[model samples]
Target: TPVNHTFGISGGKQFKVGADNNPLSFFIVGSHGTNYSYTGELIRNTTSDGTIYQDQQGDKYSQNINQLVLGNINFGINKAHNLAYNFMMVHANNQYVGQYSGKHTESHQDSNDYTGRAIRQQTNDNLLFTHQLISSWKLSNKMKLNAGASYNRIKGLEPDRRENYLSKQDDGTYILTGSNRQKRFFSELKENDINTKVNLQYKLNDEFDNTNSALEIGYNGRFVDDKFEAVEYNFDALSGTFPIDNLQLDDLYNQANYESGKYTMSVGELNTYNVKKNVHSAYAEATYQLTSPLTANVGLRVDNVDMTVNHRVQHVEPGRESIKKTYFLPSLNLKYDLNDKNAIRMGLSKTYTLPQSKEISPYQYVNIGFASQGNPNLKPSDNYNADLKWDYYLSPSELFTVTGFFKHIVNPIGRVDQGNSAGLLSYSNISAFATVAGIEVELRKNLINRVNTATSKVNRVSLGLNASYIYTDLEVDIVNTPRR
Candidate 1:
């Protein structure tokens, strides 16, 4: 892996008032970031007809500049009551430039690899704003209440343009053909979300067992709305011969200046879509000491999700998609202390992983050699997991642990190849069931711990290591797919 070059500047300030017991404070932070890099394979030389020829090299270039500002304010009415507010805003501009060798003749072309001279550029601008407010109150000596609400809004613009310049090659090398080919694509998205949550925690005083216990309950609600628009430009440029044999990043950027209208752009395909999501959830958890050296914790959560999508179709009725899903998740954890230096723990849980916005959106993302399309029919995956662990403490600064875990997953999602001329990449549910098992061990030891009183020099050295081996099996049909 190669690291990109980055430059960043950040500054913050804080103001506080009142005494330590009850204080009001406000803080603000701002940052500016800039990053750029060029990535590509090593240059290669090929010998043909007893002559050494340098193969055309491709480069992927990217740049990003962003500004982030965040601020927070907090105040306490008394020792038992407090309120806080936080807000953040981020603005960014990012660009990706991909260049590849152009296509070759049928006799010399390779289906699996990209050949030829082509350049593609995509630039996007993004803005995100978020705000949250929270309050904490001590209802009693054994009970506390906490509540918060948050709002977030995001806006982005994605625009792509590409140019292809090709000429007949007798010796497997490109020539300046002077024919200019260009295409443009543009898209935008605006999204907003609001969430509110309230939680209560109560302490259980077990005077007889002389142990600690607690119970917590919470409710949460969220609402979200997203709008998307995309357009492809259809234009006919004048056929002209150019003097340049090879295209450069600077040349592409100069030609595809949308803001300056360097090239004529016309609407070809127009797509409009919108999505709405609503979620409601409730959860409860309890932790209790079963014995003097044992403890157990159990939790249950229920969630209801409602989602709808509206996509405009050409020469047809509006395409409307909607779905409602509910999930009941439960988990249990148990711990037993054999002694002051050794302990055993066990856990079991059921969880679900939902598809993200880009995964479900009916959009196409194009690259130089490949393109990825989203699936609107994607479903969430479910997981049932269990784990057992043992821990041994050698000292405060050293310890060792070993764990074994298992997971059973249903409806897993993975990338699938469409095997087309466009080199299409799409996502789908590849397996009905899958199982994974793993064991991991970790150790941390301090080699040296000493101090020189007269010279005031101290040396403390430690070593930490961890490793895991996992085995996975999937029950699915793999016909006409690449083997792994």
Candidate 2:
């Protein structure tokens, strides 16, 4: 059974410049899409004493997708200042074709009936881009200023991905097996980032008569770069007799089977990487009216991080690395106004968690039921937070809430199951300590406020429900590790 199709289109525009007190504006939007699918499947593998390990495949597949949405356009060159842009792209294809009909029974002691036919194809290309610039000023009469800059980019590609395996002879034609030949894969990934910010605010009294004292300060910056590469190619049969016909998709690879020797190509072992990161932050905050239904906010922050990595697993070895960090962070917030439909809240925080660039890029990604690796000494994780809150407001359109949270973590990165790679999967820090606790409850209801109703079944609905409960604990710390 095969039939699934989708297509889309979208558009928008608006423009008006100057005039109207202080105005300048422009806006634009766009979208495009495509999709198609055909699938048939039934794959089985069972064992746990029920026998029949790896029993089959009806597994037929086809999928194609293309999407491009470079939407979002912002405007305003007057009344402060602004700019924005965003873009996204995707193109994907997946193909798996025919006859892998059933039963091999854990490599046959006698449950055989697996004649084989395999063809696989996978492709994906993705991208995203973003930009923003902002400004605000009126640096007098109680002081104010703001600034911003942003840039981002991402790309991913997997090309050449192909696979072939065949065996079914007896004159119906098909043969290509040096046990299992023809496989080609190539992968690439890229990332980019730039960010900057500045802020200053002050108004300790009368911005309209001393309501609360206020002050703020900020500086933030970020820079990043990442890259990844992969390769694989193998095609056996260096001598002839590589026959294949009629099982379509262009029967066999061309150039008359690579100038007539039928096959021979090998290359695997190029899993490359590069990563760079920079982070800088400075912050200050103050807001008070610590009396009069009580209100307070206090903050302090400092951070500097630099990261570098250059890995090349070419022939093997040379897993470069670097890291530097400094942090001094703190925060607090509290508010109480037990009237006006009740209110109380509290929060405290300190945080850190880094280890990206594919989790410190050591790079290993093998498929067909498992393999994942990365950890060039991977480190960075420290977070502590606390929260408590209460809210009630049943009228300005309903509300009720409750929250409780706690977390304590240090060097707690996770993703296990690699006691030296059998079926691999890695990412570590195993855990020096970890803890999390949670509680959340909420209820909001509006039901309908559409004045005028006379039951012909008046319908206008609004209702929401929320729930939560969480607990976690970990303390693993490897080395002689025997606890599965």
Alpha-carbon RMSD of each model: 6.2, 24.3
Candidate that would win on TM-score: 1
The 10-residue segment with the lowest total lDDT in model 2: 102-111
TM-score of each: 0.79, 0.32
For residues 215-333, could you state the per-residue lDDT of candidate 1 as single tens digits? 99999999999998887764444233333354353553355564566445466557777888898999999988888778889999999988887776333345776768999999999
Model 1 bad stretches (over 4 Å): 1-21, 42-57, 102-115, 163-168, 171-181, 207-212, 237-266, 313-318, 394-399, 419-422, 441-467, 478-484
Error of 2 at 394 (Å): 72
Model 2: lDDT to the true structure: 0.71
TM-score of 2: 0.32
Tens-digit lDDT track of model 2 for 56-167:
4655555555555555666655545455554444444444434454443332233355454555667666666677676667657677777878787878887877766665
Among residues 3 or more apart in sequence or in different chains, the pairs in candidate 2 whose N, CA or C atoms overlap within 3 Å are 206-210
